[model samples]
Target: MKSLSLLNKLKDYLKPIREIIYGLTLHEMDLETKKARGNLDQLFMLVVFGDLVGLPLLPPYYSMRLLPYIIPSLERWKRSVLRERDLTDFVSTDL
Candidate 1:
């Protein structure tokens, strides 16, 4: 009936509103997860190829093997790691 159809239409209209509210509440959590993932990725890359910066934790051969696959992001990652940090950078936990 008509009542059931009206209920369904109302639900369809509210679906987007419900998702928006859920997204708003979880936005911060999603940002933190992304930041943590980036940090972990950097740590993994460092462990695999720390020799590039003169920290020979791993052998050069293994690092070279992985170099090609990581080359694309290597420059950006290096810049991020090597960039100078100021007091504001230390204070900012947004990342």
Candidate 2:
């Protein structure tokens, strides 16, 4: 019982230190990577389905071939592509 309690105490003590280390070393990189991935996904969607929004780059035959795989995110991609943005939208995310 005492050993279990000591182990619990040790874990509680180490938890914040572990989180601090992770925050200091890995958090910013993780956020940047996620941001990059989102940008890439949006760009890829634009390439694949831009016709729906009137900026057709790829030919229709290929877009039709890929339609099934892209269906789930189609609405979200359209909304994201068509939404209005301002300078503050870009500036605030960096901070």
lDDT of 2 by residue, 3-90 (tens): 9999999999998999999999999899989989999999888788677667778888888888888989989988997999998888
Instruction: Give the lowest summed-lDDT range of ten residues in model 2.
Output: 86-95
TM-score of 1: 0.59
Clashing pairs in 1: none
How far out, in Å, is residue 86 in model 2? Answer: 2.4
Q: What's the CA RMSD for each of the models? A: 4.1, 2.6
Candidate 2 vs. true structure, TM-score: 0.76
C-alpha lDDT values of all predictions? 0.83, 0.87
Residue-wise lDDT of candidate 1 within 35-70, one digit each (tens)? 899999899777865777788787788888887888
Backbone clash tally (model 1): 0
Q: Which stretches of candidate 1 lie over 4 Å from their true place?
A: 1-19, 53-55, 59-65, 92-95
